[model samples]
Target: MTKTFETYSNIQSQNIRFRNRFGIEVAGDLYLPVGYETQKNPAIVVSGPFGAVKEQVSGLYAQEFAKNGFVALAFDPSFTGESGGAVRNVAEPVMFTEDYSAAVDYFGTLPYVDRERIGAQAICGLSGMALTAAGADTRIKAVATTSMYDMSKSMYLGYRNGYTDEQRAKLREHVSQQRWVDVDNGASETGHYSSGYHELGFNADGCIVTGESLFPEKLPEDADPVSKAFFDYYCTPRGYHERSINSTAAWTATTPMSFYEFPLCHNIKDISPRPVLFVTGENAHSRYHSEEAYEAANEPKELLIVPNADHVDLYDQKDKIPFDKLVAFFTENLK
Candidate 1:
């Protein structure tokens, strides 16, 4: 069945699978523009918004890129959607970053792709992974991100760097205790730690409780603006997909451990000489991430803010996305 939130008649799409360096099979949808076989094409690897599967916004981006004449591949990350991984619903930083390179590897083998012109585009949380991958993997000639998020920094420092040293210590202790619990239970615990950016899950009894659906059926009266916005997309027919983690479930209880330890996008300067583009909504709560990336990056980087748009707007809002700018960036740099 076609799982993507959007479909295009002008582009050809195929379900494809390839393995990452760890031998886990990653699933993706490859989109090719009309007459793709006639000539070589600059290819792009796309993924993101963290827990979302490829069928959501990533697929939309790929379809649009393909329609605009770039070969685009959007994939489910290592442990989500149709991708293969053990103990599903866990997020590992290193593995996630490697997934970008895996997509590049898949593109390199394609006869219709120009290997030297390959690029990557990530949305939300995966933006950090895209930048990290492009830094070390020179094969990714260019990179771009929309509504960028630095997951590592967020995990370690909390939203807007609100976590105090005491809170950080408490979080570490909680996760460490949870590890022992998992070892004894022979399975990973699952919970809703992401509900409130600052409210990490911890019951009165000190046990993590399973979270309600990530996408609530109805908006809570006191729901934060960000939560409400996310619900409008992930819970509604507009962006909901059965396979999306954000729509149906929660991550493993200790999924934050790796993100806390492994910093990402620290190599932003390494991507110098090779261009990078940071695109974010001017009103997005996550806009700081893109701004920080642009500041840390060396020459040949650009930061673009779409007026009056929020983080979720960039996910599937075609009119809000700067497609022309993205296409021009890749076209100018990938060549």
Candidate 2:
């Protein structure tokens, strides 16, 4: 059984499973507010921050939302954690976005949930996928994102759009060649692009695989600030969970292939009638992602930045997360 990373006195949680459109069984923890059985309540489907499982940050958010009188579901996306899918640790953009809608489907069947008032909160990398789902599925009445990271944009343009034309071409060339190699080898290889932050692991047919563990047992003296911040949360008992990909494993080598072609939130304008709330740390490296998304989004949108906080700080830092603002946004819009 997966351990509960965070819990609240006013909330009750139960393990649940539901199938997505593709028939993949998705696992989730359903958190109900103290008086949930008495009447219908607004709901939120929460997940994200890339490789993390539902037991970590998402679960905490779900519990918090439940404590505040909203029925919330924190789920593991397909192929990660307890969710079912072939070839573990693969990151498929289409399926990931579909998971949000699947969560909506589950909530709509619950007598205690107000389907029309349902919303979603996605953290980190899953923010993009959540927004994409909101754009396509009108069921998600309101959407919010914290510490947003557009994986597609990051994969295509590199961190801070640092990749030059030649660099992008070379990376794409390697990825294409790697696909053929994987087909011939009869297995998906694990590797990461040279851009952004990643620890090096074993070599597979000349590909430098991302490390198995996101952080080492002991911190290295020369670890960069970004890696250090992530390490302090995911590697420590404060936020660590064995099933989380961010805590224990790396994504498959070719996972970035589909992300390169598909840009998330390309249809940000489609979610106009539905409100969007973008929250990020003022000092977070990924603050730019929320800013870019906010600029592209139509009216009925908000961008909230917490002072003196970094990217990972928003992951589990209760004091800096501005939960009141999040609750107010959902309450005002989901009504």
Q: Rate the local accuracy (lDDT) of all candidates.
A: 0.86, 0.85
**Model 1 per-residue lDDT at 278:** 94
How would you encode candidate 1's per-residue C-alpha lDDT over 57-152 as one tens digit per residue? 899999988988899999999978999987677788899999999999999899999999899999999999999998999999999999999998
lDDT (C-alpha) at residue 4 in model 2: 38
Candidate 2 lDDT tens digits, 239-321? 77888877776676667778888888988899988999999999999999999999999989999999999999898889999
Candidate 2 TM-score, true structure as reference: 0.92
RMSD of each: 3.2, 3.8
| Among all candidates shown, the one with the greatest TM-score | 1
- lDDT, residue 239, model 1: 83
TM-score of each: 0.93, 0.92
